[model samples]
Target: MLRRVDSWTRTLRHAKPSSSESVRLVVERLSHEGRGVVRPGGKVGFVAGALPGESIEARLVERHRRFDEYRLLDVVEASPRRVTPACPIVERCGGCDLQHLDHDAQLDHKTAVLRELMSRTAGLEPAVPEAPLRSPPFGYRRRARLAWHVPRRGAPRLGFRQAGSREIVALAACPVLDPVLASLPGRLQPVLASLRRPRQLGHVELTVSESGDGRPWPVLYLHLVEALAAEDRARVAGFAAAEGAYLYLGLADQRAECVYRPEPQAPGYLLPESGLRLTFEPGDFLQGNAAVNRAMVRRVVEWLSGDGVRRVVDAFCGLGNFALPLAAAGLAVEGYEGDAALVDRARRNAADLGLDDRARFSVRDLDADAGLPDGVDAVLLDPPRTGAAALAAALAARPVPVVAYVSCAPATLTRDAAVLAGAGYRLERLAAVDMFPQTAHIEAMALFTR
Candidate 1:
């Protein structure tokens, strides 16, 4: 996918402003990364902070022989889908990309991207489900890690890193975060900067529970590169008690020490339809959007148990997040995961839910699996970003009746889909959900049948 660029292009990298010429071009479309695509002087131009169907005047910021990067100065004409961004510093905060576009339009764009990736990468065109899966476009993210940057000459900055750079951009609040967690940056600004060991402080992470009452309660993680001073620890503990949210201090080795609370609170979110509550720790991996996650699990169980599936294999299952719900639907499920801690939590969750006999989770390396689990008639895979390539190959050789794969990367999903296709599995149903809105990323689900 990577091609060699000619050395000749490097000479005219960033044209000096005095010598640089601004070009007026109509925004043609959006790149996979959500940048505006255009053609200026017959060269491919990518302009960030610009939307499709917008005419903009941009100066050349960086140039390559294949594509040129432009900095948008003025929008001569704007698209009807364009809307004012919700966050004041959204353009610079580097947290979100599509905040300026309509929420519905963002969903449409995600679906299109998935469709395009499938066709281009897998040579298949699968139908998207009629019922679109998505959550609220804003204030849906349950977790956020803010970068802390201190300057020798000026005030410290606490926010996300600048767009495409390591420099931090100060922020008052982030709309994408759950409001309870969103208020941390603004509230902790003074407190963090005033700490005795400011240089030792790394960053702050906010995690929250999706309380079914439509409110979020948070627990903060204070990541530290060095040891925290006793005085600073006391202040953080006071801040934690005052804020009514527990604080945890983490070291470089991933080992953590609690400040206010002795243990990190494992927040549980209720999957109302399945009558299940999924609990996860502060650093545990859970879907970012609570509403959409519940929807996704609902959809998965619906697909898994629709045909009266007897036994299903849940690969790469983490903390019984998916397997528990499916088992609650009265299906026999065997869940496999790589993380021993997550495997323990999954088994504990199964026992606590009184579904231990129906749902069992064990530690297994999915990447190295030689074959599908014995006795399972159907399969459900919720793989990480790297995807289930080897597992897909294994499944391909030994065909199963049904396979439902949830993926975070479309390219990887399709690459695995091709293997399934070669083994006579039909790509039956595919859908894209905006689990993470305002960003270019999309979460997808696909059903395959032999």
Candidate 2:
């Protein structure tokens, strides 16, 4: 069923390429998803792999009511900022988007993208400071999820899919993955080779963390499409023992029950520069990059320390990432999360950090209509890509004095920013962080003060 549907989707025909069109349209701006937005015939069209001021021939893929999406046909002319891509597989693999351009230019483009989104989507124009980018653009990804597939008659391979397709691109080594976890596919290939044909390996999850004893160890979580046999379990255990990495497997079921072998020290770990350490289970949600995450927390704390601001409410807070840090800084912080288990973990983590008295964790679904406690000096919101519409509305109704929003999605962030701006809050500052270097995923921080 899956393969047939994938094949049909792959065969869907796209619109004609812009080769004979006499009108030349220039790219005016870039979309949040890294697509170029151009106005042709007073209509908007999104061009893939395009930069502002670049004129390129693109093939239209889909025509919507408001806009159209197009694919790069040929770069008739190139932009000055455009540079040769470093990785050979960049064009094919969807792993990284901004690798073709220089890192400095990438930062500039992101800043411009955010500025456009803020001004157009929201009425206010925010000033963005020159935020630092991560060094060594390649091989920085410490975690990855790869699809497992074996050709009908050939050997099995593991990697990500091509851009805008379901076809998996087999990879021997990934430059973005951690060196130790990157070698897992090659090391485990032999063990998988012994399995029967059409073995049920769906996806592979790799995470690196430190043990309770302060020893670093990599944990590989395998989600299977079928039940594991005795030999399969043995192979996993043997691989974990040999590779010095922990192994956790999720069986295929209605709920997909996860089973961990040989006791895992921790599913994930975070060691901040401020002497705050966190350990979470495998299924818990945590920030991908640790260094930048700590920096973001510290920056937020620094911004919150002002006159008459004695208390803070962290909405959508996960595992006390912001709450504990704020508490450590001697502020009365209250953290809320939707997950009950995560809320418990946050409390435990705060207690472990000797900050339980200063910090409090509560399980509150921000999506619903929940009442806020009195005397919330400020609100720190870190919501998912859906954005915190409900929370924003509630915050606006109460008219919070300050809001520091950390968002991964520019479109949704701008939407929420407009809502807050409507309620008399003005966007004061914006900063773009290249949390995901290679990909078009841009992490931004926006501050709105009443």
Candidate 3:
């Protein structure tokens, strides 16, 4: 499902080239995915790693009836906006595609991408936000997944997957990693190298949660193919102590064998502003950036409460992120989620906070359900990348005064926005949040009112 540049290379290598020779062209502009666009023979050429206004000799990799793709060979002229990437292994990491582009310019490209997508897909051009909600460009990620690889006879390695390939790019520290996890890959070398069956290791998940006292506590969840031996557990626990992180071991097929700190004392993060601390399962989904997520929640409450919305439904709500905040403000909130485990967690969170009466969480699939909660004046959506297309259509027939949509996928967001517009709702405010600044991903919160 994930697209990669290596797939283009493979297709280019297998197909017969229109000509044995290649052509040189100037990059016109960048596409939404950070590829440079060039038109040759009336066919759009997507050149990865090439910037606009740069001249490059590209080999025709694939030729379709309407357009073609190219592999960048050599740059004859470089764009002035280009600069050296911050990460030494940026070429292989594939995690940050816009690192080579100027930092400030990346923001511009993202904003432009958002605007273009809205116009093309949603048929409405939203007014650009005054500026993107941003934080430090680096060291902002509080969650990361590292792939583990071990050759038949070579030393085992831990890091991220290579661009367009399944191979692992070994590394010690990543610039964008949170401080708690920045040095973990290097520190795990001894553990991975000494494992009895290295092939049984899968990957590592690093998460940082804020304690009740406002201190950051790092947690490590190890994904293994087989059970961890008694000796191996001691070794892992020792490694966790040395790294100042709590450790948890989970097997792919064995749920009963999964072990961590214990029940009721799981790793958790606190939102002091809302007077709430949420504990999530290690495998549950949470926003990657800590600072941005808090700000996003605050913004959502501000928007939802502006028009005196006393009753609201938080669709696709996970762990009561939005529902709890709104309920705290005296609004009766009904949060709907597909995962029963997360719904239980959300209910438990409300009960712990003494808001169980007002903050009600239900387990239901938003994608499948057509009818929404009754007696709600407003709706808050935080769906996955596929977007809330079905929910948006359902709400169209029953218009509300306020609809606050939080989206990570601009294309799908705009598509849903179009549906909401047809239902007499107009876009009121749009704020771009740099959830993952170094990468091309952009998260935004938009308000639609009738």
Candidate 4:
């Protein structure tokens, strides 16, 4: 005789749900990536666009051995923190997530994720949990790359990529971009559609920098899959001239050629709080949010300031964003970067600010085992998403008094934090920074001290 199987037991015994099958589940909490987590018949389900403490009906989109991914069909119960997104195409555009959640709730979620990662991965907690560094929720992105696509039977499409797909979501305006660039896509679409060879256009990079006189300087870099005709070039130049924006063309060899510029000077931004100006090229790496970047720099200076902390080493320093400010705070700084061009730019920025005597830059492979500098009292780490694993191991051998780590990815940061913990360093301070406001990206700062 077969044993009686209840509905829940039937679900557990069955294979993966079909793509069209809809399941009603109560969300337990949010995952690190901001997706809602639920357990239906002991099987984990990740639902996008669902919030914690809410019930939702979702359809299975993808299946995995241990868990399943679902797309939200309807919110059976809505959370109080939910808000209507400002962007019309937010559901389709991959530019940002968490826009449907309240801005304050987003900050709380980021901070909780950072703390949870530290505890779970590193087995440690900060002695001082500092308040999050925040900027305006909208209009905070100063740099963006917009995609261009030309279909077989339609006008050229230009905007951000669609969520979880290669299809381009054509957008007229983006609210998260800086005011100078918010309406640029709408203006550029008509010009691009007018081009004889719009299919050859790959993408466009937009950057807005603030001049010393507080004027907005807009720069556009157009990537080309194939060379444009003479008339097409002239038309693009005329559009740039009319908008009073600098234009550059990206060649096949990855070189940028300036096509039009109203001023003789390169584009740059001023750190008025630090009393310094930094200039960068077309493809240079920069912090996307200007306000949070400045505040983060100031916080780093404050954390490393002391008579005991005289000499500091900045690993993975990009164009002296933090090193120059530390030097201005009366500390001797030695910055090492992997990019020779960025190192040269850092050196020039130091000299321009008259901090060359206090700050120095050198090109070195950070991934290799290069030991810490001699007589270094403190170290500041700002590595990429991969984190500074090799450097962390090297620092463990010759530990410093203070270590300040600024990370854009929390998982890697926790992995490196464990290395520091093994070196007898105590987690002293931690703060989550709201660099990318509407996205699920977490930027954090942690201080370790021996």
Candidate 5:
């Protein structure tokens, strides 16, 4: 009877497809994260690297009660919008998604996602969605954080984390990064491997700032679990000197100490259009794509440049990216940020530009009931991903004539848009900003007015 029962169990197992089994599926659409959505056996499945309207064979990697996860094995039918990914390890690298999709289609996808969220969540839609703010699909990223790991055995690995994994995908080059930053990983690999305690080095962040002559001024921040030896420090300094890159050593306390500097001045980027230059220290929040940031700043100034708009409030302002420019555009701007360090930096930047009288920076906790400043004609907010629900509620109570919201997450943006709508603010203009290309991430600018 036991043998008979075992035989029946075997038969039942073969009756249906099991986990890790390959199955053919037709992708219905792309999820917000750029994963292809499908339904197999009446269960939703998310398959990475599978385009919408394509038939593909995928292996079930994970099974959950509501949805399944799949790894693409073969594409039986490919979408016309698909293209060969530029990165050889795009499949495994977590740095970028939607690389296989055409660049134009990527913009369309982002706009569609934004519209869907606004219509569904906010119950509002723009009369006309503005064209997406464009950026070069490749070599546009000005900043990158790479993970470095020294395995128990084998050469030390340095690159981005693997997709959906903590494992590091060692890279020789990354095309999406700025040209100067793209080559650093390969060159730094050997230097990191030479360290006495390589595993002590947790990660490295690379940022590229352009000099006045259009030369790349690269900065490297080395995050360490423990202090490096004098010899190791010297070796890393030697590499920085050779590359003409500024170096900062991040200690266990999360303080970055400048170890090497080729110039007396701190590294920063210029908004030539605004005739302003802003300097920032290591770990400061900066927009990754400089060109897009400039365009974004310009758009913000233009959108707020209406008659009778004399004073503006910039919330969650970091180093005065928008406030300084607005002041340059002849508006009195009050910039508020949570980080005291950033607030100080913004003030210094304003002073350097001689816009201190017009632009003032204050350190305020936006998460709390930090009421909006009075006598401000317009409000501009660029909140982090948690998305200014508290601030949105505050804005609902005290509605401004115009509110420009810069959002990185559409879901949260729509959630806040609902609050503004309740306060009788109509969605005026909405545009997708291609701030980070070759990725599923979306940045949007929305204008709301009473």
Candidate 6:
């Protein structure tokens, strides 16, 4: 679907491609990579996703040498409506990028981009596009990784990387995070300070649970290069109590050095709004935005309300995040996951939530034979970055009347969208959620119905 530009057009002075050609151009549109495109005379300069129609100064971030490449450098005339970002390290933290824009505006940009991608990238007609579903933009992320660095020249820091770089960004606090975990940095430094060489620490894992008081606790995974002293063990225990973080010293890996650390707790998070819960160990998959997740669940439920779906198959179901909630709502749900551990955990969660009767879990590699349950009314899939190509092919041949495809990446979704369109499933809805604010990541939900 790439539009082939004529070589003659390329020779035009305005359309000439060069790295040194610089001009302050208005951001006309956002590309799939979350960069803004500027029509400087004729050639296009891809800037980091700045708002469309907004005039901003940008510098070249990369150049093909033969082609124009640039990154947004400054927002001198930031949209008056642009609000100050909530995260103290918003300028440096690589985790999010759209926080400066109003939440609603971000949602709008994401929605339009998805639609445009479908039209431009997949050759789909704009008029034939689906209605998009919207989700809450904040406090929805249940999983995140924090980098570990000891304080020598400055305070020990734990936060995300800077945008477009691997360099760790020092942060005072992350506003989008659950309040419980946000206070961790202050308390964690003192605990790590006792280590012989504190700066050698590597990483931290944080996950929030919806149970009990809805606290965001660290399943503290410390990556240390050396063993902990006996005094360090006692210090770790005291720090866990004081910081409310469950400490696990890596004796072999990064956190095993502390002998006095308590038992390690697995990283798990719950989605109460959907009557569902997902359990994952450190570094596993979980949605970045929590509020948007609730909104996504609500949207699915709303669609189900009218679909008359009974037998449901959730392909690539992660810990029954969607299947369990749907089952709890009276739909018989058969959930599938690639990981056996996740399958077992999903079953346990269903039993604990009293939703076992309606929900069931199975472990199957989705890339292999998709042995589906017969007489299924719908198929819900939340695939990884690659999207669900095989599952889409299977569903195309099945009698599934409704299909909900949730994707974190749009390009792959569009590829699968083309395949689905060929298989008779019509693109019905595409909703964008600002899950990682101040960052380029976009979470989208697409519904296909035959």
- How would you encode candidate 5's per-residue C-alpha lDDT over 202-238 as one tens digit per residue? 8999998766555678899999988899999999999
The order by descending lDDT is 5, 4, 1, 3, 2, 6
Compared with the true structure, the alpha-carbon lDDT of candidate 4 equals: 0.87
* CA-lDDT, candidates in order: 0.80, 0.74, 0.80, 0.87, 0.87, 0.66
Question: How much lDDT does candidate 6 score?
Answer: 0.66
Per-model C-alpha RMSD = 5.3, 5.5, 4.1, 5.7, 6.3, 7.2
Candidate 6 differs from the real structure by a C-alpha RMSD in angstroms, to one decimal, of 7.2
Each prediction's TM-score against the native?
0.91, 0.85, 0.91, 0.94, 0.93, 0.81
Clashes of each: 0, 0, 0, 0, 0, 24
Q: List the lowest-lDDT window of 10 residues for candidate 1.
A: 2-11
Tens digits of per-residue lDDT, candidate 3, 409-445, equal: 8888999998998888888777677888767787788
Choose 2 or 5, whichever is better by lDDT: 5
Candidate 5: RMSD over Cα atoms? Answer: 6.3
Residue 414 miss distance in model 6 (angstroms) = 1.7
Across 359-439, the per-residue lDDT of candidate 4 in tens digits comes to 999999999846786899999999999999998898788899999999999999999999999999999999999999888
lDDT per residue for candidate 1 within 34-53, as digits (tens), equals 88899877889887767899
Off by over 4 Å in 3: 1-22, 127-130, 253-265
In model 3, the number of clashes is 0
Minimum summed lDDT over a 10-residue window in model 2 is located at: 1-10
Q: Which whole-number lDDT from 0 to 100 does residue 354 have in model 5?
A: 96
Q: For candidate 6, report its TM-score.
A: 0.81
lDDT score of residue 237 within candidate 4: 91
